[model samples]
Target: MPRPEALVRRAAAAALEETGARGAITVLLADDAAVKRLNGRHRAKAKPTNVLSFPAEAPGYLGDVAVALGVVRREARGAGRRTADHLAHLVAHGALHLAGYDHLAAGEARRMERAEARIMRRLGRPNPWRGAT
Candidate 1:
């Protein structure tokens, strides 16, 4: 398997290709409460999820990708996958969204899922949406 950090960064890069982002992205691993605060403050979701992205105003910088450690562990357990793999995928997905990959529609959803699958395959992780277990 790939090293955890490398996999996460690579996934982020893979996601950025479609996001049109031109700047360095900072990836931070935070706890659930921290993620919840960010989610509530930024997204008004009130609950902590797996990952969140912050878009920077500066040119050539995509801002930051934050993954909640607690949620990641919980998600990994639910998916029966390694925590690193799950974290890496969420990190990439968050970065992609920050870069502007939206899955609010069917076509866009398929494209995003395809991008995620390709990146995860390249990183030696299973496609989370495959439903094949």
Candidate 2:
């Protein structure tokens, strides 16, 4: 909606604050092509996802977050949510990952989801996993 970069930075800052994580984070707001390339190169996933996080090794640097603008827009349209809200969710999700949160297991998923819900609520947005089983 407004400036995607500003939205991402604000959302990320909120997430990092909520998680008590301190560091400088970088976020890339790009089209599907750039996200797809990064996904393929880093994760071996050929398709573009809504967001991806790459942790940094340098001190005082948290990590890099990449979001596919097209993908996020499509998902927001499908979910009946505003693009800006959806962007905040994805950025928070990526920031959580940068903060060492994961959902590879069922228990881990529950933990991560709870954290995400808290972040979304703090942002005055709905929980992104409201309908999930």
Candidate 3:
């Protein structure tokens, strides 16, 4: 199996292809405290989220994506998926955000979901959104 960074890079390449993003993107697998601080500072959520996206202000360039590793592990266990699979999905979701897709609107949500499903299918994994039951 590949290292975490390798997995992330492969996932990033897949995400870029899936989203048609034209530039580089960063991925950070962070610990709980680190992600919690980011969650609080960036989103004002006061708690860590599984993933966060900081899109670039530039054209054709997406910015950094951070995933809370502990949160992802817990979520993956709860969802009955491997940790790597969950991590890949979160990265894909962040990449979609970088591609300027939003879930705040119904049409946008559907579009994003389709993009996510396509990416997940390519990854040979089940759709995380579909497992919402």
Candidate 4:
């Protein structure tokens, strides 16, 4: 398998292509503590999440995405998914968010899910929404 950074970049690139988002994005693979700190500082959440997206305003830059290794591994184990696959899914999900996708409403969620599924398919990953690993 590819290194974590390589996998993340590949997934993010695929998501950007799928969303037609232009500009550059930075993907960070971090530990739980670092992610938790970011989550608290930015979102007022005290816990670590699998992934977080930070959109940027500067030209030619979409945003930054941070993924928590611990959270992703736990989630993958619990969901019976490969850690790499889950990581890819979360990375794509974050990239989509950077591209203005959200799941705050049913319609928005469906659209995002479809886009994510398509991106995953293009990456040769399974449909994460259906729990297909």
lDDT of 4 by residue, 50-107 (tens): 9999999999999999999999999999998999989999999999999999999999
What is the descending TM-score order?
4, 2, 3, 1
Better of 1 and 3 by TM-score: 3
lDDT of 2 by residue, 25-44 (tens): 99999999999999999999
Quote model 1's TM-score.
0.87
Stretches of model 3 off by over 4 angstroms after superposition:
58-60
Taken over the whole model, the C-alpha lDDT of each candidate is: 0.82, 0.91, 0.85, 0.93
Clashes of each: 2, 0, 0, 0
lDDT at 105, model 3: 88
lDDT of 4 at 83: 93
Q: 1-133 in candidate 3: lDDT tens per residue?
A: 1367866777777888986779988898899889999999988888989989998887666899999999999999988888888888888888889878889989998898888888888888788788574
Clashing pairs in 4: none
Q: Which has the higher lDDT value, candidate number 2 or candidate number 3?
A: 2
Whichever of 1 and 3 has more lDDT, that candidate is 3
Report lDDT (Cα) of residue 133, candidate 2.
Answer: 52
Cα lDDT tens digits for candidate 1, 32-131: 9999999999999999988887888888787888888889898889878988878878988888888788799999988988888887887778887888
Ranking by lDDT: 4, 2, 3, 1
